[model samples]
Every structure is written in C-alpha cells, then in structure tokens.
Target: MCTIELCTIVLVMSDAPRLRHQVCFALYSASKAATAVYRPVLEDLGLTYPQYLVMLVLWEQEPRSVRDLGAELGLDSGTLSPLLKRLEAMGLVERRRSAEDERRVDVVLTDAGTALSARAQAVPQRLADAAGLSPDEIGQLHATLGKLTAALNSSL
Candidate 1:
C-alpha cells in the first residue's frame, strides 16, 4: 500500500508540467514557430518575413511615408531603418526623401515589388491551409488574437 501510494504521488507530480500554467510562454513559442514556417515560404520569393510584411502594407496602399509605414506596422524608426534598407537593396522598394519635408522619407514599391503582388496573392490561402483550420476558425482566431494584441499594445 505504501509503495502504491508513493507511485501515485510521483505520477501526480509528473503531470503538473502538462497543465496550462505558462500560457504567455506557450503563446510566444507558438508565434515563433508560426514565423519559422513562414520563413522558407517567404524566402522562396527572395524576401524575409519582416520584408514581406512591409510589402503587404505597401501592396495595400502605395506611396506611403516611412513614418506612415512605421505606424501601421508598429515599428520604430530604429528597427524599420534596417528592414527598409534591406528591401531597398533587394530592388523591391525605394526610399526617397520627401520634397515637401526633407526630414520625411517616403517608401514606395518598385516595379519588381509591384509585380511580386501577383505571386503573393495565394499566400493567404496557403497559410490558411497550413494552419489546418477552417475559414470560421481562422476568423475566430484572428478576432481573439486581435483583441489580445490590442490589450497588450495598450498596456505597452
């Protein structure tokens, strides 16, 4: 009886880590894994995930200023500078100083960048398939994640 009781105690303790105790850490890991999966797919187009995000914004709206992109992407100037430089180097984007305000920098897509849109049109569908989720599931997930992001963003 003593040995059986000891074994039961050990088994119970062993199951502790399996509980949803570290929700934040689990979410962080999930986010990184999702990005990893996107990496190879984005690389096939000669772009990084961050670069792809920048393109997504420009594809939706053209001839935006750097500050405008930064605000939309929630990136600071320091972080965006290098990413913009890389995109510019890849001939996918162009950065030029605004004539009206020398301090303002505009970010515009090049012909190559604009052309890349046709190739990218299928990415949303592909990602949806990869997620192994239905359209309704994706919508629900997006709504939940959006709320989570908004809450975190406001606190920050």
Candidate 2:
C-alpha cells in the first residue's frame, strides 16, 4: 500500500496601499459606469445626463432660482448658464429674472418639460434593471454615498 501526503499553504496580504483599493478611484469608476448607463436612455429623451439632473430637480419643484438650483446641483453659474441656455432653446425650460430680485434668475420648466416627466418616470426602474441592483440596494447605496459626500464636504 502507498500513501500520499498533501500540504496547503496560505500567503498573507501586505498592508501597503494599492490603486485598486482606493476609494476615490472606485467612486470615480462607479460614477462613470453609472453615467454610461444613463447616456443612451437620456439621449432618447433628448437630454444629456446633466440636463436630466436639472430636470429631475425641476420636476420636484418648479420655478427655482438659479442660485438655488446651483446649490442643489453643486454647480456654479459658469457651468450652469450654458446648460440652462440649451434647455431654453429646446423649449424645455424658461429662465427669467426674479420679479423681486433682479440679481436672481429663476428656472421654470415648459409645458413640454412637464409632459416629459411622465416619460421620465420609467427611467428609475430601467436604470435599476440595468445596474442589476434591487431598489433596496440602490437606496442603501444612495444613503451611503450621501454620507460619504457629507463627510468630504465637511472636511473641505
């Protein structure tokens, strides 16, 4: 009779930092991936991803001041002005100086923009399906990201 002996060995990992373990890179990559999924869907609606984000806020509350919109979207006038201009040209939104405050500009969605919301209602479900994440999982991810954002903002 002949007997064979088997041995197993495990290697330990180093504590050294690596690019693949970077949170910032992971967030950046995930953001790009998520935006890729949104691109085609948003294009079909005649909107870019940034424009869609603006529309989402407007859909929730119309006629918001440009300053308020900028705050909510984390954008500055320099970046937002052209986006609003394009949306205005498309007849999807209207921008006007506030009646009480000339320094303040307000953005209001057009009838077409309001109507588009009905179509956009399907976007969340479609995005969830494309991401292969359940609604609960998405919610948890959103909450976690929000916390991360808040922490970074506070640090800054």
Candidate 3:
C-alpha cells in the first residue's frame, strides 16, 4: 500500500496558488511589459500609452462627451479629467461645455491632433515588431484577451 502524507498534499496544493500560476499576475506583467515597449516609441511622438489610447478613441470618433469617453476607456472622471487637461495643455484636444447642457463637457480634437493621426499610424506595426509577434498571432492574442476580459467582467 502506498500512502501520501496529508501535510505533503496540503503543501503541494498551496503551491498551486503561487504568483507564477496566477492569471492576474501574468496579465499584469504582460501589460507592464507592453507599456514598457511602447514607452520609447510613444516618447518620440510625445504621447504616453494612456494618452495614445485616448487619442486612438478620439481618432475613431471625435467631439465625444466626457461621460462617453469615460465609459469607453473604462476610466472614471478623476483619471480622465487629468488626461484631458494634459491633452488640452498640449493643444491636442479641447474641452467645452455643451450648449444644450451646461453640465456636459465635449472633447474635440485640434487640427494638430488630427494631423498627428498620420504620424501615429505607424505605431501599431512598430509595436507588433517590438513584440516579435506576427499579425495572426497578435490577432489571436487579442481575441483571447477579449474573451478573458468579458469572462472576468461578467463574473464581476
């Protein structure tokens, strides 16, 4: 007869929950690595990763309400406000109160911001090259992450 000690089983099971095995940690680490890769590339364009994301959203559709931007970006007023302010200071975007609603603020891209879209167009391919991932692999990764995000959000 073979017998495994109860203490040995408990110790082994505990190791399963270690940081190396955590999905959250893996995602967190990967996000940090991706941002690090974007740092220098974005620096040349005078934008941070978060700012770039905001610009990307605006590039897709401009003159968005602060509330709309917040929801799309998954950011609250506190974080989005400062980012908008900074972009405004850089002459990249402008914020104004809606004529119909004094409480609503709309964010619109400046001419410079629109022109910057041309320069920023190369960022995606550059980032993919930096990560050494082909387009197919990047697409797969993006799809998998989308599913993961949906699963996690649904759970919450």
Candidate 4:
C-alpha cells in the first residue's frame, strides 16, 4: 500500500470569481497569515490576535472608548465585547462607564499593559524578518494595500 500527502497545488484559471482574487481576499489572507506568524510571539505576551489589535490602538493612545476602538479596528461591538471582557479579566485593561456619557464605555490600559509595550515593540521587526521581504517589497505591499483599502472604503 502507498500513501501520499497533497503538500502543494496551484490553480490556473481564466475566469475566477472576482471575490477570489479581489483585494479584500488578499487583505484577509495576509491578515490571517500574519496573525498566524504572530501567534507564538503573541502567546508569549499572553494575548490573542484581536486582543493584540486592540492593544495596538490603545498603545498609540490612552483611555479610548470602546466605540472608538471598534471604529478604529473596523469591528462591531458584538465581536469586540467578548474580547474586551477577556482583556479586562487578564487585568490588562480597565473598562469604565463614562461620567459625562453613561452610555459610553472607556478602555484604559493598566500598568501591566503599558509595560507590555516594551516587549511588543519588536513585533513589527520580527514579522518583517520572518516574511523575508526586503524594505522595498514591504513598501510596495503597503502601497498596493493602501490603494485597495482606500478603494474599498470609498465604495462603501
């Protein structure tokens, strides 16, 4: 008896669905792959992918409302709420109701969360190194992605 693993394959097509090769799919796949690459690194920091994105925003600014975080990340409350709860449980962030606006909730990083930044500051460099992409290539990718994202946002 013989067995084989289908390790690799490629498709060549004339009329693939627009969604298949669209910029949205490219961004989605790149995000998934990049998050996969960051998994171990982020795990070491005790954070998940969405949590890391939330942290990224909070790192740049402090005491942002939950709505602001969601808007910045293009996420809805349904998706962000649970993740924020987990972060609160971890004591990385504190959630508080606003005094002026009782309906709004603000997210503020803890001392531990602020300290975590020192360790996370190297993630971009690590990702760049792991991707084995030259600076020029990274720039080109950014330019292409920026154009695609802008077009999609405009379409919406």
Best by TM-score: 3
How many residue pairs clash (N, CA or C atoms closer than 3 angstroms) in each of the candidate models, in the order given?
0, 0, 0, 0
Cα lDDT tens digits, model 4, 17-131, are 6776685687788888898899999999999889999999999998999999999999999999999999999989999999899999999999999999999988888789988
lDDT of each: 0.89, 0.90, 0.92, 0.89
By lDDT, the best candidate is: 3
**Which residue pairs in candidate 2 have backbone atoms (N, alpha carbon, C) closer than 3 angstroms, thus clashing?**
none
lDDT of 2 by residue, 56-138 (tens): 99999989999899999999999999999999999999999899999988999999999999989888777789888878899
lDDT of 1 by residue, 32-147 (tens): 97787787778788888888989999999988999999999989999999999999998999999898999988999999999999988877776777889999999998999999
Candidate 3 lDDT by residue in tens digits, 1-156: 134677788778876768887899999999998899888889988999989999999999988999999999999999999999999999999999998899999999999999999999888887788788888999999999999999999999
Residue 103 C-alpha lDDT in model 1: 94
Q: Worst 10-residue stretch by lDDT in candidate 4?
A: 1-10
Q: List the residue pairs that clash in candidate 4.
A: none
What TM value does model 3 have?
Answer: 0.89
Deviation in Å, model 1, residue 11 alpha carbon: 16
For residue 23, model 2's alpha carbon misses the true position, in angstroms, by: 0.8
lDDT of 1: 0.89
